[model samples]
Target: MRIAFYGSSLVSAYWNGAATYYRGLLRALADRGYAITFYEPDVYDRQKHRDIDPPDWCKVVVYEGTVEALKRVAAEAAKADIVVKASGVGFADDLLLQETMASAGPSTMKIFWDVDAPATLAELKAAPEHPLRRMLPSLDLVLTYGGGDPVVEDYRAIGARQCVPVYNAVDPQTHHPVPADPRFAADLAFLGNRLPDREARVEAFFVEPARRLWRRRFLLGGAGWHDKPLPPNVGYIGHVPTADHNAFNTTPSAVLNISRDSMAENGFSPATRVFEAAGAGACLITDAWEGIELFLTPGEEVLLARDGQDVVDLLAGLTPENASVIGERALRRVLAEHTYAHRASEVDRLFRNHARRVEAAE
Candidate 1:
């Protein structure tokens, strides 16, 4: 099978949050005998700060992100058996959706992968005349990274023929326990790109914990957060490289996962950090949200924090031995059930089922 995936970036995790998900899913598919062609815009500023390169399993194509460029890619993408236009491309997504759908041949399966389901669906509800209104129902499949029943229901209600949750998973081979880095060593660590919606959660979960436990050290790593005011206890390291994720997770006594506002409300939306931290065998503590236990058991495999005091209490009370046990259990669970290999196999089954349906219709 030939798969054409158009997303934010594959080689760099610069400001793009979906880079890890794209690389993990596509690389897994490639390893499973699918030939992949990834298309990204040159405007993402990621290629400049790229710390990683596309693997041999996939071919990358960069374009100027103009109407002419869209035309060129559409023609070439028509040859592929499966075409994916993921959300958060940060380019002309409306144009890309229209062009990709227009270019689709009868046999090709045009799928729209919504990495940011809450944001996308919210916009559609507020504005029904959005470009995706017409584009979505025409696509063969709609997949979301987060949001469980609500996301699926909304998509179907909005006229999507088929909608499914394709949640994020870890690539253990890429993210696993490594020796801690001295620079990142701390009592609690949080790594996430700072955005308006996420800043409040970060303050509540990450910074407030540091403030409450004044004696404990905290590490914050991400881009666009250097300007944000921080307390004396929290050490801010702007833009942690993708390659150092394991080291970052390992250095902290226990890592923290803070959801963006919408994601927390939507539930079942685990950020990439959840999987990455667990994969690195770090004792993980996250904010209270619905559907969390489905992915990681609270008492045995993970810790749930409702407020600053909860996180402070957990860090102060949790012994080294207890943290180690929790980390190990989390690693075991995600390695077994939450991995890109598992997601790739799920996609394969979905594709096979789609083929049967197409044949039946014919």
Candidate 2:
């Protein structure tokens, strides 16, 4: 089967958090005998900051951000067995969604893959006239990055034909354990860009903890935080590239995962970094959220924190030996059940079942 995925950049992770998720899921699908063509717009300086060249597993088409270019790509995409319009392309999104849906043939399954289901659901709830809400009944399937049953139920309530959550998983080949680097050494480290929805939580889970524990080292990476005030103990390294993520994860005594407000509130939405850090054998401390244990065991494989005080307390009592034990356990768990290969198998099953049902109906 062939898939045409229209999403954020595949070659760049600059400001695009979905890059790794797309790569892992699609590469695994390719390995399972699916042909994929990723269509990404050449905007947001993504082309300038390309992380990886177009890989052999999938063809990537970087088109100019114009109506003519979009129309051409949409026409080409109509040939695929599946057409996916992922949320948050960050450029001409409404136009792209319209073109994708309008051009999809009857035989091609139309998918609205929501990388941020919580935010999208809120939008649909607030604005019933939203384009995606109107298109739900026509869509063959609604696949979410992650939101568990709540997301599926909400989509069903909004008249979606079908809804499924394809949670994020690590590509072990791309994010396995690496030798620790001194540059990323810290008692606790966090890697996330500064954004409105995420900033307050970052302050609660990361910044305030650093302030409370002035003696401990706290390293922060990701773009858009150069000017943000931080405790003297917290070091900021802006925009660590994808290549350095393994090192960043491995070197820290413990890595922190802070979800955006929407994701945390919605629960079951583990950010891609959660698996990436675990894949690199980093002891991870995540904020309290629903359905965390479904991914990683809280006390054994992962650590849970309710707020900055919990983070500070966890760091204060954590030892190198215990951190290593937790990290190793988390790594083993993810490798066994949460790798991209595992996810791809689930996706393959879903597609096959859906196809059989469609054929029977016909």
Candidate 3:
């Protein structure tokens, strides 16, 4: 099948967190013999910070951020067997959502893939006249980046025909153990762009822990936070590129994963970094969330923390030998159960099955 997917930049991870998720899922889908075209806007300085050239697996259309350009792309996108508008496209998203759905043929599958379901859901609830809320009933299906049954139930409550959670998974080929780089050496490290919803959590889970443990090294990477004050022990590296992620992940004795407010409250939503760190065989410490055990076992494959104190406690007792053992165990679990190939198979099955159902109805 031919698929046209509209999302934030696929070639840039600069300020876009979903870049790896898009690459992994789409590349795997292409491997399964699907013709995929990804449409991304040339906004957010992402175009200048291109991480990878357009891959052979998918055709990427970098369009101007204007109504005329969007209309043209929407027309082209409507010709595909499936047309998708992923949440957080970062520019003219409401118009693109409407245009993509309106332009698609009757037989074409219309999907709204939400990369951040919790935040999206909250927005929909706050404004009944939201564009997606109005369009939900018309969509063929809703696919989520992560949010187990709760997200499915909520989307269904709002009028989705079908809602499925395609949680984040690691692309073993893209992320794996490599020689640790000295520049990233730290007892614990975190990589995420600073945002309002996440900054407080980062302070609670990452900064506070660093403040408590002055002797241990803590490295922070991602956009923003250049001026944000940090404890003397915590080192800030602004915006590590995708190419250096493997080194960043492997070098840290343990890496941290902190979710935004909505995701933490809703639970079951694992940030893409969780899988990326695990893929690189890094011992990971994640803030407590529901459905974590479904992905990695607590205290065995991963370390779970409820607050800054929990993070500090986990780090204090962590030995290099034990961290290595935990990292190895997490690596084995993810390789066996949570690879992009595995996720792509699930997505492929859903696409085929949905097609069959639509045909039968006709």
State the lDDT of candidate 1 residue by residue for 143-216, as single tens digits: 89989999999999887888888888899889999987899989899999999999988888888778778888
Clashes by residue pair, model 1: none
Q: Indicate the residue-level lDDT of 284 in model 3.
A: 96
lDDT of 3 at 245: 95
Pairs clashing within candidate 3:
none
Candidate 1's C-alpha runs over 4 A off are: none
| lDDT tens digits, residue span 110-203, model 3 | 9999999999999998898998999999998999989999999999998899999998999988999999999999999999999999999999
Cα lDDT, model 2, residue 229: 94
Local distance difference test scores for all models? 0.88, 0.93, 0.94
Question: How would you order the candidates by TM-score, starting with the best?
Answer: 3, 2, 1
Worst lDDT 10-window in candidate 1: 70-79
Task: Kindly give the stretch of ten consecutive residues in candidate 3 with the minimal lDDT sum.
Answer: 70-79
- The digit string of per-residue lDDT tens for model 2 on 1-362 reads 89999999899999999999999999999999999999999888999999899999999999998889988897876788889999999778888888988888877788999999999999999998988899889998999989999999999999899999999999998998999999999999999988999999999999998988899999999989999999999999998888999999999999999999999999999999999999999999999999999999999999999999999989988999999999999999999999999999989998888778878888
Sorting all predicted structures by lDDT, with the top scorer first, yields: 3, 2, 1
